[model samples]
Target: MTAPEDLALYVHWPFCVSKCPYCDFNSHVRAEVDQAAWRDALLADLRHEVALLPGRRLRSVFFGGGTPSLMPPATVAAVLDAAVAAWTPAGDLEVTLEANPSSVEAARFADLARVGVNRVSLGMQSLDDDALRFLGRAHDAREGLAALDVAQRVFPRVSFDLIYALPGQAMRAWKAELARALAFGTEHLSLYQLTIEPGTRFATEAAAGRIVIPDGDTAADLFELTRAMTAAAGLPAYETSNHARPGAESRHNLAYWRYRDYAGIGPGAHGRRGRLATTRRRKPENWLTAVSRNGHGIEREDPLDPHTRAVEALLMGLRLTEGIDLDRIARLAGGEAPVDSRAVALLERQGLLARNGAHLRVTDAGALLLDGILGAVVRAQTAVAV
Candidate 1:
């Protein structure tokens, strides 16, 4: 039998050049940063994690953040070097860095690649100038494309994000823009619908009637069109918001969806290893202070009960096209099957879920209403188990 997949590493860089109005990620903008001190702190934080979860290979390393592209290549290299030294790296270990499509950040692509970043995910939120302006992005369509060009040339694997269902966006306009984006020939795409998240500028605008997003019917149409177009382009939806060609999926993300162990290092990063869930301090200064005092900037580290792990595993795994392993869910739940058989039967009859041998999956229709389905199923299962 094949050995279990190794742990994954997530290195968070919490600094950004500018904060987007809609972003709620643990990102902050600072006029001045001490690059050396930040680098040392990240390395120190990573070492603390290594000591806790020893004797495992690393399957992937993802550099995510406020804007990881803004990170100096030297900082990235040091972290990668430290990780490899800490654990044996898989032969095809995927190292992905999240970047913004700005000209200055794009200029660092070559240097980043040279230092062992094999994949890059660009935040090219929209291909339209107006959309970029409305979304508060620094790069325009032309500049974004230029950055994408540079990324594609420098990295062996490339993925970019695009936001759809923008305020006042029409179906025809979105379809045309998506087509333009797909023509770039990148193997992976993360397409997200714009939601007025709580505490965001968009939320305030939407609440005040200053911004109007697509209605439910229009948003559904856009979602359907996205699936059809990307499938036609050979990049089918692998997750709710992510599409990729066969064999070109993001491995780092797969680790999360598949419920595998990964270490999250840096401010506001969350991670799971074995049964422990860890969260780091959210602010940069606070994280640095904690790391200096405790050797790791962890804010909380809690041991997850079996039921919680099972629920979380089911929630994450069902988001994938391949679905979850029922056997693994059972193991996580301490030998009790995690799904309510009656609910599964009902949902399967409704064509929202499917059971094929050992796997339980959400059908395409179910994916659109995944949150509701999960809530119902989890409630039913918990009730039955209790």
Candidate 2:
């Protein structure tokens, strides 16, 4: 289905059962939460934000986390209800929730599905028991599969995540995991590389040379293998780290990659509307208080320049196999993309990028070198404009 024009909503649930050592998201583990109070605060904040973007048809609503599945299903339903009440929903609008796989969560699948969440993306980071433990995941392979089974039975569409390119991972091992995951008959899959972001335990360990991750070259090779295997399985990378069968791509995520307008609600959430951008308060309690006191909890707001928007679009869109749509970029930028013709030409010669009519796409080789290519392309554009 085609995306509805120009709008989506992101509802952030910034609480988790426990924090993973490698995670650096705006999530916290707390012994208790006042669900009713939280429900009221988030609903108020969301309605206020919706007031700001009135008349926009919302195409999708994503309940992203800490661990959204941990939220009481009643609270989840309340947010979903508030979303529809606040805006117009397009045909086949998708409501998605991010959850972690565990038998406990599996039991809640039916409850979530009943509350307008027709899509469920569960975090099943690895199928190997050892890998799961190493990643500090709470579930074992059996529990993960059990949860997936429950999610598939309850939801119309189900997606699960897996992480590859771990330390000491080999091509054969990764391929085996991919094959097994595909065998689960999931319509959508997310295979991500293990990134050691600063402030994460993984990064701290790596810095002291106590932990070892795969080298850059090895990671690149594993990435290529992932693409080939997924494509062969009839699932292509519609966006970076996401693979899905035709018509199964996440609409909510597509809303982000397409650079459409979306409202972010919840602690530490970010929102963009045309050129104006806003970030919500990062602390849950503070957010609730601000919303109660002033009808909203926005902490920072600014308008981005056209060039910055274009650069963001390029950064996000190139991750898709279909690459950047020139028309969309032009419409958003209010002018043509400021890409350097010479840089694109050089990339074409290097088999890193290919021009297709009005769009520019990264080749298989280009996807392999995306980290470097993005920097080079941005610098070339800067130099050419100068």
Candidate 3:
């Protein structure tokens, strides 16, 4: 379990040059932006969270976005400066920024690094030129690789994403691509299967039968292949979709999957602090307005009851290879463990779940069936808050 005083910070940058067809992240495209205004607003929002979450040590700060690389380096620096000043810094304080693998963004890497961004997660969604076009990415394979090379040189730690299980993608094709990706030798990789999310352009195409991803069986095969290959490459699956060498996992993301306290600022960022869940305004204009009036972009701050907190802990912690402690969940729930005893017995009998005293985790064979397992295991809550 994470200490209460250890905190992770997330700052959202909502502007993108263009939206990806498959993305549903809180991102927007606009013709113009007032960089100075945005920088000031973000600082104000950060200060607000800092005020509410005093006596904390900041461990990780993530600049996730529609495209955070688009932010002016000065803005990034200002936010980082204020954040570092607000909280006691952790010994291994990690600062990460997400970037699109484009020449324009790559050129800013050095400046960003100079301003305290030591890690970068590049959006090199595919390594094939044709696949890039199909995914509606602005950068071609050549540009993406060039940007990656620049990132590897500029940032102390680098991780990139790749989308597999594209429509008509063959297992052999994905294997070759995965081989190329692993050979890049980055300490971390986020390999994701292509899914048609609701409201994404891909969803519309699927609805019209104009596109179809791999069947469930084929996708499962691909998932297994990815896990085996990455594990063999020495960057094993630390989480369901993220793989990293030992001691190289993303600290900010790990804070979330481990169900730790984090503060979120800027447009559409969500944070968990103590017993409260916080969310910011999703639209850029609205967020700015909120900041101007209230000094924070928070749209909601809801207190989470014990049962809700335990269920959330289970849902997130089970995503990691190292599972949760039943005792921990019980403490969070302020009662018994939130899981059904009978369900655990049945899943354990089926070899899908494992238990070692108070520790419980989903087995490798059950990883793909995690959704089903979670549905079965988390018991419905009826206890009233005391």
Against the true structure, what is each candidate's TM-score? Answer: 0.97, 0.95, 0.98
Worst 10 residues of 1 by lDDT: 377-386
Quote model 1's TM-score: 0.97
User: What is the C-alpha lDDT profile of model 3 across 205-266, one tens digit per residue?
Assistant: 99999999999999999999999999999999988899999999999999998899999999
The per-model lDDT (C-alpha) reads: 0.92, 0.86, 0.94
lDDT tens digits, residue span 1-386, model 2: 55435588898899988778789999988899999998998898898888888877878889998999988899989988888877888778898999999887788889898888999999999999999988999999999988998898899999999998888888899989999999988999999999888898888889999778889899988988888889999888887789999999998888778777899999989988778888999988888888889888899999897777877888888878888876676565657675766788899999999998788988888988887777766532343232
**Higher lDDT: candidate 1 or 2?**
1
Q: How accurate is candidate 3 locally (lDDT)?
A: 0.94
Better of 2 and 3 by TM-score: 3
